[model samples]
Target: MITGGTTVNGTGVFCACYIRQSRKKANKSEASPEDQRDKTKGYSDNEGHHFVDFYEDIGKSGYDPDAERKGFDRMMNDARAGRINMIVVHYASRFSRQNVNIVLMQVLELFQLGVRIVSVNEGEFTSNNVMDLMNIIMRFEAGHNESRNKSIAVRGTFEKARERGGWLGGLAPFGFEAYKAFVDGVEIQLLRPRKDESKVIKWCWETIKRHKDDTIKQGQRHPGSLAGLVHQMHVDKVPTRGARVGGAWKDALWEVTTLNRILRDPRIAGYMAEPYGNGKKAAYRIQRNADGTPKKYGYDPILEPAEWWELQAWLDSRGRGRGLTRGESLLSALRNPEDEPVLNCACDKSMCAYYGGGTSPSPLYRCNFRNVPGHNGNNTMVQHHLDEYVARRIFARISTAEEDGDTAGFLLEATKRFARTQEAPSNARERAQLVTERHEAAQHLKECEEDYKSVKDKGPATRRAVLEEMDAAETRLKTLDDALKALAAADAPALPIQQWINSEEGNGDPMGEGSWWATATLASKRRFVTLFVDRIVVYKSAMRGNRWVQYDASKRVSITFAGEGETEEASEAA
Candidate 1:
């Protein structure tokens, strides 16, 4: 006996429709939410009454109804509050799984809560007396049919969308744009290379090919013009998404920074990448944290193996920012051992390059192989800082050991581990190991060379085979030379370890004149550190109280005091 329309605030009325679609319905080829929303809009017109706002929990699997989702709870609350007099649903199962029998509970609960209910798909409700087993069973069958039909439609939509590579929909990189293109469902369109930047990409590839010299530039000297080439794009009025982001040239264009995107674009190599960088090409830049330290390899690769090497060569030759390589690595350390080298790159390929050549210049090392974090971390150092970092670490360690009267023990242990010390095989073993590796290498080279010489130049393929053999022989010879050097041991202390370990500045100070310390070459001093300690990491000071940084690279410098037992990055995770 409802008279004036029941006040929906605390007295539930009009139908509340629940449109439960299959979980597989999400991204399925069936109709979109917008279209479904529109269809629901029509129901209000047909019924001639206002409805509670729709509650959508679209992609949820019905089996777990209380899986901490939003929207669904709000609907239930309104029902409990009697704010909704009637509940409308496209079907009963839309409210929950059939096995849970949620529809009967919702009906009984609303009735107890002082709310009346009406279902759009099911017939109007009556007194509890008439609603017998036969009626309830019929209603359940209707709901089951609706769920099945909806599932079929959704699956058809997804199968079509996936085949077309349509707009699955979400944000992508910075440069390219996205659009729609599927037929049965929503389609996705990806970025294609723009014309202007392609020319520049080609230029970079050509440069790498041009620089591939074995004897002429055997050891890898990065080319000098990589920066100029990137700049040239700007000079030629080449447009980039860089223009849109503003600080591009000054921002992304720098070496190992933005310029890498241009050179590494796979569009220049051949085809579109599986998923490319935002820039017109599928150029994947390495991932980094907000602070600029690399987090992992980039999602997309922008440079080619050859082009990347070329860029490294160019940066190596530059010596600093003016010629700084694109990313961090040990090359920087090699260029400026006085400065610390970057220790690692998180690139999956793991082989990071280093660069040096700046004021208070420091070398850097890190991998650029892949963009997966922790994946390529070894190829890429998780972190690196300051050029003298490793040296500083070793010196500091020795200083501590000297203070603790463990100087002798530290040096002895270090030499035993990494150098040819007394504990090492005596002169006889040293010479034997050296001669053995050398003999093997020499034999390998001779055999390869002989094979090459004996091969007749009967055809083009024969000549090519011989050339490959000769190249292999040369590589083997170089390996042999390096190995023999490693085996050669000199036991005589350049600076008597006992003196260095015993002096007042024992581990703290470098050798003094003939007074209390012996002399050693810079090479030897550096070698001493490497032979014992591994690496050191520098860090920004912490703001927390009484912060101390401890370096654990088995080495440290005593050039300055780190203060009362402070811990640095090295200590946090060495």
Candidate 2:
């Protein structure tokens, strides 16, 4: 009989069996959960102990503290609650492979609670016996060391395989599938393009490219948004990867999130990516060489590196929180010289486009948040009026520069300023450092604002102090923003302004039908506006007549030209 104190129900020692198998050995034949449970049950029965229950943690890693082992926790809880006098396991390692010190503490805690731990192979452990304690400690140490060594060996093996372009055995990325191939006389898995999935990926890139080309060359707007792509795919009945449902494979529908993932994945460009951590929301960074180029696997690339980079640049230029929508109109890429969105309501929310119903003639830009409670601004303006007013102002500035024989110098300076707003830092290390600094600054500013809000009912002196802190944080953030802009400017590529200036269309009158401005693509017009304008601020119309009557652009609009400190009313009479 087992020599254990504190028997439950005054009958025999109540024992609970704990079984664990790490994910690495989950599929192995040896030391399975069932095998461990059977051995522990036989050992407990041989010792005349009553087996009350079994706690099994399958495919769980004992070494990782963050790994959730629900069964192990429940077993511990049962022991602490005096429900079980003994705990049985096939081996000490099956109970835990945590650090030796942690295991020792757990064993001591169990012993203090009058619970004894029994291992089928290692025998019983008692608090009074020095030999038993030492044996338990040594067993835990051995388990930990074994796991550590195996981890190191496995990591080294994976790294070497990655260096040699070998697939490390997991589901292949969306556009490809894994296939067995002979490498160095050894059969190994490699990625091969899956035709159906590859076609979807190719279609996405082609659509974006065509949309961009048409906007820059033919002044045509096309439906190329992520949402548009999803709609078209549904209409065309494009096949996504199938999922098994009730033993039958069912075709999955394409979604924006899925398409976004495909667009953002570096694997499509044939580069390996390293995950940040094991968290569910953890991001991945593309592995790069010393020269900052992405490290490529041996698989055939689905998209060219240049094409992928260009796509990324375009996406980034769209800014945060802006939904991927149709790339239409001249103001799609509109921003001030400082790179801030130019169209903001008096209530401080950014304006959005609103297409009127079939009865209306033109689209309108208005504050989408005007209907929200406590928001009072209802700023709305016709889209074409603003577009034409801005276009005319830009053309006049270019005409003045040309008349003064300073077109070359004027265009160069303007292009450089515009490029700074559009470009990002090229040096990866510098970019990462800037990003970290920006995040910290933003966090500090947020804390300051939260503190100010929390202490609003406090003394005036305290509120003032909090206000000062907030101002300081805002200043620091602004300084970081300026630094980022300067860094981007240093890395900005030269614009093709010289070629545009030399064309025959450039010499004609800008307001005339034959002028470059008249025929310039929407993308080109936006580029011109960004080069010459610092900001465009719109105010509510003051006309006392019907709201639908044509509003004067000069009365409601203010334009701040680049390199100017003063804002001027946008007027044709200027």
Candidate 3:
């Protein structure tokens, strides 16, 4: 009896057939988008309504917000524009499984716009009659409840499987393959190390540990450890896990980000990470027991706990003060000196590498803020000259300390200062407490959910209280998770000077030709500089010199070593 705008046929009502399939169907028995479309079309035909258009949202959740459901949004827009006066869906659930109140409001809006919604399984949804209104409310509430219960059940199943050391369904982590086997007469998926991939992982750990000692020839380039691994994998034609492309499986190229993820993933250490919910950021939070030790799976681990922690520590150390820099340069760490205050121009702004065209075409360290009005100073210094000056100063200081028999004290104080500036040493007791708090919060969340389900029909007030408790518990869990992640990322004790000395042995003197400095990679030299030097203040050139004359760096630069109160002028002679 509802009137509609005239269509091409000009007589009967124009109906838009809407179909939705939320998630892939597990089996053919479950209704698909095609099935929903057919049912809606048949009902439209039976009612003598013209099927003007079809709108389908395949593999889109009905509970998603209206903006996320593209087909549904288009259908509503068309109905509002009088292109169609009714939306015909296979069932009310196909239209929406949003909150009951939200769904009711949408339906009311449609009715006010002179449009109506018809569900083939249920009848025309109308607010005119009390019974019809009650039926509409019950239909949407039922759909919402069904989706919520399904989500809870699925999470519980995954958690139980995880606790039992079973691999939840997904592509296995790199360096491992998933296999199904019967455990006590029940088949479950499990992960096992893949031989070739495992070898690559082992090589990565070994290479990264010795990365600091890697040397580059005069013209050859070294991309440090993480990027170097990617290049080596490509050169060796190392195959990554195959992915399906256009119906055929293809191998992906090794990437720096992928390598980083593999190195950071706890699965390599024989533990599964907790599954995070949608919209939550993922972190490698290993499932742990009440005693705060990682829970093990039924497979061999590629890296021991100590090795994994060592790798993490190395990564944390590298991540700090990392930024874009021109090809292998000693002052790379000083490029962004906001945090360390190590390298500064006369104008107080951090100096950056500037490659410009002039009579002196080589790269120069120039103040980034020099071009601003009223900032007048000789802010540029030849890169090589400054680098040589700083390196000589460091070598002289080390040599002096060794002669004075104060090397041990100097190294100890320097290590402590570096550790303090870089990152706080992770507290074991604090980490354990955070892990325990997360466990308790998770348990409390489960209890709240169960209470909500049990008392849903009791009263609105009771349901709200339970939901509030669930939210609070979830917030607490998130906080604890973030704290645990911070603790994991905190730098391990800075590498001892003796370790550096040992690694650099058999090279030569610390300052002479063929020495550690001559062969050390740019990354290694940067680390060395950051560990020993606290700040370098550059002043305007004090002496007039021509291009033919050797610039006197001693008069223009001051070097401040870590744990030292006074800044020392650069030595006149190396």
Total clashing pairs for each candidate: 91, 0, 0
Candidate 3 structure quality by residue, lDDT tens digits, 46-92: 88887787887877888756537888888888777777878888888
Q: How well does each candidate superpose onto the true structure, as a TM-score?
A: 0.35, 0.69, 0.65
User: Which ten contiguous residues of candidate 2 have the minimum total lDDT?
Assistant: 213-222
Off by over 4 Å in 3: 1-11, 24-29, 64-67, 126-130, 164-169, 179-190, 209-212, 217-225, 244-251, 274-283, 286-298, 313-384, 391-544, 547-550, 565-574
Writing each residue's lDDT as its tens digit, candidate 1 over 1-574 gives 2223344653224545555554535565333445555555466657665666676777765545445445567667866655555555554555555442655765567667655444445555543646643465466656555656766876787556544533234533333345555455465464433344444555665665564221122134454355445565556655555454565243443343455654443333322333434644443332223322223222233454334444444443443322333342222232222233323322212133444333324343434334364442222122243333554455556656545753565555454434444334565464544444444345445645655676765677887866765576567567756754554434533334455444454443444334132355444443455454433332222222122764332222112212112333333321
What value does the lDDT take at residue 351 in candidate 2?
Answer: 64
Candidate ranking (TM-score, best to worst): 2, 3, 1
TM-score: model 1 vs. ground truth: 0.35
> What lDDT does candidate 3 reach at residue 366?
71
Q: Which ranges of candidate 1 are over 4 A from the true structure?
A: 1-12, 19-50, 59-69, 101-104, 114-117, 125-532, 535-574
lDDT comparing candidate 1 with the true structure: 0.45
Total colliding residue pairs, candidate 1: 91
Q: Among all windows of ten consecutive residues in candidate 3, which has the lowest summed lDDT?
A: 332-341
How many Å off is the CA of 5 in candidate 1? 15
lDDT against the true structure, per candidate, is 0.45, 0.69, 0.69
lDDT of 2: 0.69
